[model samples]
Target: MPTSSPIPANEFERVLDLIELDLDYTAQHESFEDLVKLAARVAGTEISLLNLIDSFTQWTISRHGMDMEQMPREDTVCQFTIMESDFLEVKNLMLDERFREKSYVAGDAALRYYFGVPLKTPNGYSIGALCMLDRVEHTLTPEKVELLKIIADEIVARLIMVQAINNLKYDLNEAKEVKKRVAHDIRGPIGGIIGLAQLISQRGEKNKLDDVLQFIKLIQKSGTSLLELADEILNTDVKSIQAAPELTEHELNLLVFKDKLEKLYLPQAKNKSISFLVNINPENGVVPFPKNKLLQITGNLISNAMKFTPVNGKVTVDLDLELKDNAKNLHIVVRDTGVGLDVPKMEAILNGTAASTDGTSGEQGYGFGLPLVKHLVDGLNGTLTVQSALGQGAIFDIKLPFN
Candidate 1:
């Protein structure tokens, strides 16, 4: 009675796991099917398979002249093929001592001649085999065996290529999404600048001297904001910008916060003939925080106020300090008299679900400023409060604890 050789259970399982057979090979690809057909034609065999073995089963990713998709590993000659580095061949399965007792060899289908080229990966794992079988005994020429090895190499190359293509596709899609986000961030400031420029040009044409100077100032401020935003986008590294050495509270207090605020909001207020006021409580002078982050939070809030407030409206920014429960808190408030929000609009704006809308002077917005402010406030371990009524204007309050 003939008996089959022992299986290399450990090595087989390791190779199976490394290739990740199911993910790398699937019948959906026509290339695999074509490879099987070519193998059968070149080897002069009635049956051919691109086989992958996983533990207890031999799966045919692609097959020619076979109706079955899989079979027990114990019954298939391909199982023995995976254990060999080079191709395995049997001139007559029924005459071979190792395979004559195999059920398929003695029974109905009567698989006889066999030639299998082990599919080896670059990392040196023989995952499975590219095999050919016939019902009658036959000898494969040296040329035919070389052809089988060539086909196996092609199969492995194609699989690697597919993986590369999938990775490239994923990277391309990620790049597109980043581009959209950057563009969304950039559009708001640019739109505000353009609208302010148009206002300046119109005021100059009509000789509206009183507001013309204000519009010009606003254009300068918006232009500066736009330039800073461009720098941030180009660098694409917020951590690097925030990694600068921290400043003491007293040092930050003396760093011209009032001047920065005036430069940011005064022009926008003047462009619309709106009253703009900034009151800093001198006693609540310095607080330790990242200057860039604080500037972003305040700048975005003030810019938003300028965008939403109407002509002859009022926008007030107040900075003060409060001692509560022995913990000092910095309170920043921006209040604007303009079209106010209802409940849903306020929620969407805070939650980043709101779509950007044009401001009172046909100004364009990307609806990203408030969400960015919300993110910054969260990072600072602060609280944000919004109070508004339809046509009654709105107020944004932020409270941050001193470090």
Candidate 2:
């Protein structure tokens, strides 16, 4: 019944993927196990289930009125339910050819008025079903079928959200691993750069002094960029940012940001032969974000642009304001004319695979950029979207709550 191939054994990733199954439903969440109980009670049914179909079995992830944990794939009502596109209702299983001889339906208890809605993964993989069963023959009106889909949608959303959180945690761990290796490996070369630069500066002939100094400058620039990349990894925790002394409500400091960015990035950007254009929102009016948090998020976006984009490519940043109903928000977008993403990176992010990217010019990476952006956005109840067309460019858009 699974729409996609059974999750590969290696990809099952039980440590991070199955958090909800391992944790009790505290006050914060009503677990799927609880939803099963509620469903059976509401319909006055003999059984209900939140089940996931594996390669060879229909496993009841959570059960209320049923003792069976799973059944062979061929015996599953879920398999038949999956054959249809939407919620299904068989008011009387015994009367139909499909169910008349099915052992589970004809066994110790009768099953009638059966309804189930399929649950799909965020990336469009069909994973399982939420179903309710009753013993008495009955008809489900169109409205009831609609209601079942609505409830099923809620179930899908909660589970997918749980899975998304799990995937983010995986990304954070992978980023950390990349960070550790990068720090351990880069020190010797960085030290050699500084030492060689010093040797050349102190004793090189005047005619060659300019070349030596230029080499020193490039080393310094590379070292600084590497340091900033490491800093981005360490700053993933949003709570580490100091709260603004006073939350200012005025036009944002464009000149201050420009100055700060130039000081932080001029050498690295120049090394890459990249040009940066930072523009403020027309409204420019600021809200209540802690300035350091804003800087970390946007600065990492810029850092990635400089790191991965090809030489001489242009990276432009823009901001806009959105007022929806009673709330205001900020939409900041950074786009680069770079060597864009390939199919693999896009699919990997969508399917929650490992995170890593090599920089152009063989600059290498610590692999923390977008993951850090995503974590900070999650902390603030915001949104981040990454768009890229192979051979074209990449654009990142982040939405932050304003007021």
Candidate 3:
């Protein structure tokens, strides 16, 4: 039997690897504000940190009510707290010999009432600590410690999810890069070969023009397939990054949706003889949103509709605003007269594995569109539901609360 190796001495180094591993995930925070806020809230502390211990520094992935991003590890009391492999709540560090002299407790990022919960990775390694601190000492009730532990668990879950998504993204990127390198380099030569073949076939005896056109069409089709592959490969990275900006109130109008979605998928829809239109109820509303995210969600729907609908079929989009007791919500519906899916297929859509059909003109694509759409919608705290009939049409209902 193989013996297990000792755990890495540097937790920060380990977590740095974790962060890197999670960078490609959709849940990977572009910033760690949520974690910081959660830490502070759970511990009821004036300051909190999602701190990772490095070789020489205590790096703060997130800090509530603090400006510092890092501090010397030598000065970090949280470092000592994390090494314990258990939850710690020091009501007053000055009275505690272990941390009283620590500069993090005695000096900067000053600590009085200190609480830290180790953030463990899936393999039972402590990657970091979620710490809450106050400048003044106060007694910590057991309930507070339990709450802090819960928050730490939340942080761990978030980080793990980020890591998982990052892994998927990594695999996707690797596949994409390999495919691109193979296809891009081959496209030029393939095009030249097909072009030359067409020329030779055209110059041959009568009635060979059709054969040449068929060969050229096949080459062009292959080129188009490469283009689609390239788009999916790149979008796997661009679309998957959880870079949605903090929510802000914005004016979302028909024109905005049109300029964003209609302009995006209109050409594709037109090529399929699919008519796309937008209908806005109360055409204008102030709903809090991350504009880029909203755009991404709608783009998925519009594009999906365009891809699935029949030639001359209409894809209708409408936004309805509801204000109840000052709590506002936007109801968005996308109705398409297309080759509507059955119940099992709709469940597949929810599971993010539904296979997509070609557009009216046999437009080809992979099946990632709706999966990404569902993910973006969920990220916005929205609910998405689908209704469809096999031959009649499909309806997508998305309801989102304003930020």
Candidate 4:
């Protein structure tokens, strides 16, 4: 008598994980169910199942006549069937010494026959088996077994193709989301610039030299913003943005930060007739931070301030280095004298539930800016605080550790 050998627990687990079968094991595939039906017909059996063996169980990914979706690994004949590379057929469960004591044989189902072909991947892992079962003793011809093996191959091929299709769809959806975000972020600055340009053109002969200069500066700022927007879009890999590179030494520079901020936001404030101030005090020579992420944070805050603040209102940005607990931390504060937010509104904004509203000048808001800023802030291992009151003003404080 041939004894059935049990697979080692650790190796079984490793193979199961490597197969990645759990992803689709519970999913309904009409084609796969049809395959099970065809398998049962070809083997002249009363029941059929496409079973994937997990660490401790046999999961019926697809089935034709089985009422149960799963069974204990010890109780499943598929377990031993998966051990071999080819088809396994038990002539009669009552006659087979290894399976005669099994519960299914002695229970209500009264199983009497079994035939299964291993579903093997190209990488040589037998993930599971396509099996047929019968309640009466039966025999399978050599030709039938060969046909069963071919069907098993077709089943494996279908599963692989379905998984590939799913992955491709995921990637496409991700790219669309990234494109939508980029368009939304760029729209605000572009719209502001267009509005300012139209205003300049309408003023024509009445436009003063100083006013024209400010408009030009604002337009220049918008163009620079577009460039920065392009940089962010180009550098972004939607699939891997979550694991973006950390702040690196070669990428950090205090001078570039000061220059970019002044160029980007000062004109925006001027166009809005808002008093804009920036103070940078870097005690260290090198400012170690993710430059693009910092730009996104500052750009969103300053843009919001410019949009909300009325004429003659003020916006101030302060950046300094602090020594706390023997570590150098960067401190940033952006305060605005604008129509501030109520507690609920503030909470909603921070929690990404707030709808965007028109600015003081009727400029449209993207509503994603603050949420994106918060995401980037958290990515940098920083903290953000918002302080505001209706009809008063708003302030944003950020703290990031450098060392």
Candidate 5:
């Protein structure tokens, strides 16, 4: 029997969870078809179906002696099956007022008998049903009913396995993306290390020992950053690819970040005869945020800006703190005076769909930089916006909240 309420209390959430499984609604699998066939045989019925019910549609994933694949929810007896915590058996559909008006009952199919058991999820939501149907009234013995219950449980188990497989596939894809991101992110730090090493080599006789030691310290920091990022992405023990790194409170030193950025891009800027500037509000000497993630975000943005800006152009980075709702928020703006982005490219970059484009210096790319920046910003519960025209310039504006 159906419950008094027309819809289940958790109907919306249950349906959404079902949809996320990404099941194939059609009855195409041989195993599913066999189970439905066995179900019909055990009940001595002419028809059977494995049906998943959403809010408005009953999707038949498997069937026996039927050509149909789906029906309106109002036309499905399985709708009542899902509503029930257990089996729903209407021995004579024509005699039940609730089902008498259904098209399958009153129309050409003329279905009269139905015996269904809810296919329960691990969380106890009845997402669908496995049922046997007939054109004439039929009865099930106690022993046959017990067999049907076992088969229904089997169907539920297989559905769960399907969901697990789907999730594993998604995880594997995420892992691949993480690898690409790691490779893309490590490039900047590695480049900094190489450049700093060259500077030390060139200044061996001319530079003071203290200056050489400073460059060595910079090289060590760059190498440490490179290693940290690689470890974070490669270490799957914490499921880091799926989880954002924990945010820190007043741990990010703005001064160190500013120094690192200048050390990284100053060489490149000078090589191209460009003016590069980094500005951090003195009031925000330290802020609450994940230092590594912030570095990754800003580093990627600066790298992109430097790559696209033509020789002799100017690139400026501004960082400030804002007080909103008594919480500290960080604002980052990276502005470049070079070849800017058009509408389509900007759209694609922001949406993570853009492919790699060559910079003014013909520097190649894997098209991962901006997309990775967008991802990191989103994981921080931050917002990123871009303003640009084809030839004028581009500005990337980011806002990140602090706990």
Candidate 6:
């Protein structure tokens, strides 16, 4: 009895690295089609394949004289080909103990000849194979074997280039997200200064010297905070930006939180001629939670609401502190009157698969806001739900437990 190749110790890591390549399953395979065809023509074989063997499936990335896309790894002769240091060649698969009972050999296809070279990565992982096959037995000359090996190297080089391109694209996206996050984070303090300036102007002659001095102090404080936040966000590394924010407990003062929220969004609403309301129940007290993450979640929600809401529309953010089952729970509701969401869009937002789209005022949204909110909520052991229909507006509800 012939035994199958032993499973590689780094199988899981190999699969993860393969996924990191972000291999395009659509038109990318066409790039390898020519290579496979060339292999078949050189070896005088009827079939040729560029195969990538992962843990569960043997993906035929490119094929000639065959219509297969993928199949179970357990049922693939190329699986053994990947395990070989040089190459595996069976002039007659029917006479080979290891491959004789395979479906392609004993069954309808009746493939006899096989010659394959392992597709090895730079990191020394044998991920797949480039193989040529035929119905009748045939021998591959030394020159043809060397030619096949050279073709396999070309294929591996192409794969490496694809992976590098994908990695560059991913890094670019991450950088964009970092900029969006910084813009979102700085809004509160910057808006505080603008709102405070407006307040000072409104108080004109009636403003006391003491009040004016206090406002100036507030402006200075907000400016300092904004500078700090800008520095931190701008200096964040790509790896840090890609990672989820840690859930760390801190004291959350509800009144201060509400005031900050008002300062952040009220002026924008006023400029847009929209109604913005911040209502907080039991707006005083300190609770333990991840303050920054909660702010991120709520800020994203409210900013999105205001962005989509039209002039004269209403956008309200309500924060309710409730005691249920001897535990403290915070409920946040952001309701907006705007062009609403369809089922597919809503599902996509929650699933983090939504694409960036233009807002009502032609404002470009990051498309990642709601998804990041969902992620933050989940990280904090919270529940988030949404209800909306097209032309009916949207309501986002979030509930977080504070023990």
Q: Model 3 residue 60 lDDT?
A: 69
- After superposition, the stretches of candidate 5 with alpha carbons farther than 4 Å from their true spots are 1-5, 9-31, 183-225, 231-403
Off by over 4 Å in 4: 1-5, 8-24, 29-31, 237-403
Encode model 2's per-residue lDDT on 164-260: one tens digit a residue. Answer: 6655765665465565556665676577777777777677575385777677677888788777856765664322212222323212344445455
Of the two candidates 2 and 3, the one with more favorable TM-score, higher being better, is: 3
Candidate 2 has what TM-score? 0.38
Write the candidate numbers in order of decreasing lDDT.
6, 5, 4, 1, 3, 2
What lDDT tens digits, residue by residue, belong to model 1 across residues 1-403?
Answer: 5343335545533443433322322223365888889999999999988887643345676889866455545567877887787888888998887778766688787898899998877767776789898898767889988998999999888776765665576556546545765677768878887898777767566767767778778878878887887787676522211122344221244235666667545655775688988888876454333243565577667767877888888889888777544355778899999888899988986785666666776554545567766766876788988999999999999998753
Q: What TM-score against the true fold does each predicted structure earn? A: 0.50, 0.38, 0.43, 0.56, 0.47, 0.50
By summed lDDT, the worst window of 10 consecutive residues in model 2 runs over 19-28
- In terms of lDDT, the poorest run of 10 residues in model 6 is 240-249
Q: Deviation in angstroms for 336 in model 4?
A: 54
Candidate 5: lDDT over CA atoms?
A: 0.75
CA shift of 288, model 4, Å: 32
Which candidate, 1 or 2, would have the higher lDDT against the true structure?
Answer: 1
Better structure of 3 and 6 per lDDT: 6
Point to the candidate with the largest TM-score: 4
Q: Per-residue lDDT tens digits of candidate 6, residues 155-233?
A: 9999888667656765666576677787778889989999999999998999999999999999999999989887876
* Whole-model lDDT per candidate: 0.70, 0.61, 0.64, 0.72, 0.75, 0.75
- Residues 127-219, candidate 5, lDDT per residue (tens digit)? 889999999888799999989989999998888776677567655655665766766788899899999988878877998889988988999
Candidate 4 RMSD to the correct structure: 24.0
**lDDT of candidate 5 at residue 385, scale 0 to 100:** 95
- Compared to the true structure, candidate 1 yields what TM-score? 0.50
